[model samples]
Target: MSDFLSKFNGENYQEWVDEKDQKKEPKNPPQKETATTEKEVVETPKKEQAEPKNEAAKATKKDVAKKTADASQTTKSKQEQKPAVPDTAPKKNASVHPTNRAQVKQEQKTATPVTATKRASTEETEIDPTYQKKKKRKRILIGAGTALLCIILYVIYYNSVHVAMPDFTDKPVTDVTKWATKNKIELDLKQEFSTETDENVVISQEVAKNKKVKKGKTVSFTVSKGADPEEILKLPDFSKMDKGSVEKWIDENKANGMKVVLEFNDEIAKNKVIKFEIKDPNIVAAEYKRKDYATVYVSKGKEVFEKDISVPDFNGKTKAEVETWAKTNDIKMTYEEADSNEVEVDKIISQSIAANEKVAKHDEMSVTVSLGKAIVVPNFANFTPDEAASVPNLTVRVRKQFHGSVPFGGLIAQTIEPGARLTGKDETEVIVTYSEGAPFLKDYKGQVVGDLPRLFYEDYHSKGADINYTLAYVDSYETKGTVVSMSNFNEYVGMSYLVTISISKGNLDQPAGYSPKGKESLGDLEEE
Candidate 1:
């Protein structure tokens, strides 16, 4: 009996132990319960199994809790051990569960990539301010260089092949352009017509020589064309044809486009055509076209006929016979009386258009018939200045000059002698006496007494009149003082005597003085 009790107790104890072990196994509750129930259902075993399983589940939960607590402690300890961070820094060491921590770690790694990317981007954005400015300056330099190049090219092109044009005068437009081109100068042409000059000539221009101009620049010029040739056709020729023949010729020439005009000329022969002309008298003989009719002028041909006849020796011919002969020979005769008494009345002395010379048949001739001479008048003497001026066509002038010995207002010597024949045509000269002012008469008294007569005579000779005077005498003599003189004086000294002189007189109006011989003597004196 004792042994049986012992075995039963041992088995109960083993079962309890086994149940506890089973519960401790790392398995789910259902699986554990199913496994435990399948083994035995003893009352004591069942109760133990249920209790142990419940305890085992609780232990497992406790173990999980402990592990979480240990991890949190480790995180906290690490956070405490790490250096303190500023409030602005993110908390990287904050405690978290395994799965949550894994997510946070992954986020930090992703953020790191983003930060690195941003840093790289900032580094790439950094650029030098001066570098940007340099780039702009380079662009400006390029533009300026391009502009400079263009300007230089323009200057070079302007210098090469530049030309100045030539001056042209009176050159035609049609020909001037050609001339300019031939001379390697650019040409600009202007045209004009002138009545004063021939046609087709240049009149003006620009771009004178030695002046610079761009290549291909034109020089302007003016040109002229002469007056219209048609205007030359209107003129006419009316030479040497008689009135009737001229009319006939005009009619005939009109059919051939020639014009004719007629004008009377007294010097030309009557009823005859003109033979000489100014506008190319030989134009008709030149055989030019009728259109150039202005090239001709007409004039009457000069009369060349000549005739000669006897002069009738009119030296002794009577006036009636000479007049009859002159009429028959178409001669004009005229007569004038001679001052000489030699020639007889009604006799001819001279002829004009000298006899025996060939002359036109109707030409007029003149002759002078002679008549008996007549006595000529004698010359007048002692004419005064007023009397000398009375002659027809005679001029007189009076002048006074200083004479040492002559009295003021006194008559001087005559320029010509008295008692000469006076004539119609003669020129005379006169001289007049003069004296210093009456207050200066003392100068005349200084002269020697003997020279006083000569001095007075010389003063009288200077008077511009036909008169003679003799020195009277000195009335009172005072040294360095004038002497009183009379108009008519006699030989006397100290006391003056008045003397009267006779002068031949006849026609006192005649020129100052005349020669006694005649008109011939007066002429000889004038010659001398």
Candidate 2:
């Protein structure tokens, strides 16, 4: 384009261009030759060039003289026109070129508008590529930044809008449910008993508080119902059974889950001891375990009076009277005899226990008897044990006879006549009577479990011995229940004895057995 313009500036083209410049330059000053001149040049060419074409041949030679002179003269004359761009970053300053703007405008009356238009266009062409690229880059950066800002805002709004689990434990159930409804969440409620938490209050929660969750998510929780009821249970009528025995039964029956409580009851008989009592006496193996337990209520035997009491005077009471009093008051007594002229024989003369001294119920009382001044032969033909034993010079030997009842311990005969002088060395021998009190146990070992109790009384007690019985059953192959063992073997008729009876439950499978004598066969019963 520069080569084209340089070649086009021939003598004729130069003359024509100068002629036009000189004609139009008078209307505007060079200060107006700004970055805006290119636009005016484009619009004015058709209008201004018509006039120049008509006179083209006439002004041909004079253009050289005018163009050279005008250009040099005009440059120095407009020494301070408005700075073209006002600087790269333009600012409005009316004070700028205070003297130069008016002077240039006034002096440039001869410069044509065409020349300024040409120069402005040339300057812009050189700078436009770099400047336009920078403008486009600025636009691209702004567009991308706006889109990124929108994305970040969207992310923040989405996260903030999500639901989070609230602390249910802090609020009541109604408040929590209301909050959940408002936030569009589902609550999974469950109830349980707790000592630390009140009834209807939440005891624990499955989901943690303040965790962000999706809308309508379900949360699980446990609400407390306060404390539950306590349950009571009783042991299998552990009559006369020791604590260790109860413990063993509990372990074997899987009843260890229950708590054991020991209490004292006076009505129950003694075990391996002189004390036992069991009440609410239904005895069957427990079928199931309960979380709570009942009191077994084992008797420590009837409550004893541990406090002290004054001794009763027994100076003249008969043996029968003392015996009756001791049985009524639950007192124990032992009698020792010695000769004395002062107190009467066959009467409590002086108590071995002092009169009016403090005494317990079980403390022994020995009553010393007295013989009259001298021994006279007394009539002892049909005397009782008391009458015969009290004879002053007589030592009595006693024997127990089961039949020919003259009453228990009654004397059948004695050595002396009704009246005689008592001066000889002699001892008196007498026979005493006894009766049947209990049944023989060995005969009842193979009897049916249900029939043993009736047979024990009718067969054993109706004849002699006194027996206390206990019944225990187990699974066996013989029958559902059959008597298998007995505890006593003394075969005596007068003494009180304990008999532990074992029976079979007669199933194909036998329960596990624990016997110190190993397992018992029908005839291999061991005495415990």
Candidate 3:
């Protein structure tokens, strides 16, 4: 009886009941219990040590009785639902009463898990295979959904850290750098010579604009260093180069000490470089640098220096002609002006050297040029006609007119003003007015006949006196061309007063066949 109680308390009460029902092969399958009895059986050890053996036995019997009743009810219900298995028959000892050794023995025999496993397998076989396939498909779908959720989360994370690339071409490098710093982007900046882009500006980008770029990723771009400086930095041969080109090179290279010196070169053309000199003697012209103290000699043709030249005679030549000659001969010549009646105006009066003299080139010489004759007029107010007529270098013309307050043959006025200068270009003839005494005929007795033409005739005509003169030739003892007598003597002349002058023809024998001797008037003599 103790062994029976031991087995009953040690084994699960519900399991024992299920075992007993299975061996009986009832006509129906039992319903499964909601709660398992394994946990309660495991706690039985602890409860058996706490309770007295008799009490434990009592509790165990009660639990067995309750489980027996539950099994009987489940059998009855299952029998009504389905038919039982036909292969196995019911055993007599397969009863819920645990006091029967044979019943416990039969229950133990049927309690093997293999039989339960086989039964469960038989029941599982009745299920449709497609139901398991559906479960497998559901598992696959669940795995795919989890994987998709992970992918979605990764994409969201990637988008949050990455951004689209901006347009950087032609933008300033500073702006690009600031953008990079703000976006946590790294930049691989490179510089290149560009004619199209300005200095410090981006020329091109390795990444396309608006393309995705992860933060902290390196982006490559080219920056402009501006137009190429190699053109200006190059050093070329300066010999025989144009002056303007050399000067430009010097200015671009900033060769402060380098200068251009123009020198005479007979072989080289003007405005072309002849040679160059650098302070460093070892450094030649081909290897010159901007910092070197260099000098470039340029050609300005040759200097002018004539070895020998002949001195020219400038007499009677114009100053212009002398200047032209001096220029051609490369002779230094100086000029001075003087008034000369003999030399013409603008003509060289004299030269420093005589004609055909030997002299060196570029010698200094002087020339005197003529400004013609300078004639200063004199005041004739206090002078007589005779004195005015005797003035030098001037042709004096005398005219007599009646004056109220002057003596006969006295000077009146001159045509040219006093202190007036007349050059050789002007007319040198001057007319002087002389006073004739009051329109009167002077006595011409015993006066030379030349006096009529020299004085009295002009005096009478100048005063508008109507005085007439008659010349009679008669035998007289007087010099030739002398007036012997006059009919009117010292009278105030009227409108047509006649003055007869008897002039002596030198006393000589008359020649020719037609010789007439008479007191003939000047008119009769003229007619004859």
Candidate 4:
């Protein structure tokens, strides 16, 4: 009964239930000893009082191990020696009921877990086979999943670091944008103008081709707006435009990158333009990347022409009158002379230009004037009658006359005198000599009067005159027969005049008596 009560100690309730339910199998038990039963039962309380709970747990395991060993030894020894039985059974106390023995046996069967109740609470439960297989499958699946995740991560990292950048040199901007976005890359887009590329085309990129880049890396790029969207210059027709207007346009547009050059043309007027020279002929709506040279060809005008002017007429006007008018009007005028019977002298004959003719400054003007008809008489002195009679375009006549030192029939003087201008109808005459003596009667002065005209009728005879000549002989202190006095000396006079003279007849022996001779009248000698 004591052992039975001891088995019902406080901690064995769960173990007792487990044993009744047969939830677990029992291990081999220890062999019993009559000698140790009372001592062991008493010593268990003392052992518990001395040791800690963990130490008691250790002691319990050791006790279990010793019981197992002792049971094994007892079994082995019983097999070897056929153990002897006790002489007789020891008697029990009379207080123990017979029914109690049966109950005790029953209790002993229920009490199989009393020893198990002392086992540690931390002990592992035995595994189920089916549950173990299921658990193994779950572990394998988890390990595989982890390994696959690692591989995926590695692949992503590799792509980010080792992937090559795409060529964007001529790619469209929108395509580049999409590529960048899908790759999760950062993009910096910039715009610029280009003449060699299409609009919105990529001109340049920051990242080089075939180079590795990380995901989300930044990229810078430039795009083209297709050949500079500059305004094409609509130039004026410079051929008709003046220089001043073209210069003004240049001044205004030079700030917009217009560069102007100048040239000259002869066909255009001065300060006017001929044409403009530009590199692009058909270009419109174009923009300039820099200043370009464009030429504006201007005109220098005709080199031969000076200025325009109006010419004046000079017909029927005198040269003097035209000269004065030309000086006033700043005209360049010159004069020429021409003879014409119909035109009056000093009158304008013709002019280079008609009236109201247009002309320019420094232009030449020529005028012609008329000179009247004129005639000059020919000289007839010192010529023979036949030579003087042969004067061109003149009738010639001669009068018999005496002239000094002139031979007979030689011309002495002329009527309608030499160098005297006349009309074509004027008559002409010449005084021709037919006698070889002095033209006038001889002077009888300071002569001895001895020499007399033996041939006075042949030479040096007195001509016709009005003067009465008295050939008187007188006595004087002069040579004999010398002329003493005369009404006129031997001088030239008109044939119509008369003359008187006196002769001295002094004797040569002494200056005494002079003789007188009878004087005769000399009539007009020309008639003679």
Top lDDT hit: 3
Pull out the clashing pairs in model 3: 27-84, 484-502
RMSD per model, one decimal: 35.9, 27.9, 25.1, 29.2
The 0-to-1 C-alpha lDDT of every candidate, in the order given, reads: 0.44, 0.53, 0.67, 0.56
Residues 313-384, candidate 3, lDDT per residue (tens digit)? 678988989999889986888998888888988998888888887666667789998988798888877677
Clashes of 3: 2
- TM-scores, all candidates, are 0.21, 0.24, 0.25, 0.21
Q: Write the per-residue lDDT of candidate 2 for residues 467-495, one digit (tens) a residue.
A: 56788876555556666665664464434
Model 3 misplacement above 4 A: 1-130, 164-167, 206-213, 229-528
Best of the two (1, 3) by TM-score? 3
| Candidate number with greatest TM-score | 3
Winner of 2 and 3 under lDDT:
3
lDDT order of candidates, top first: 3, 4, 2, 1
Query: In model 4, where is the ten-residue run with the lowest total lDDT?
Result: 37-46
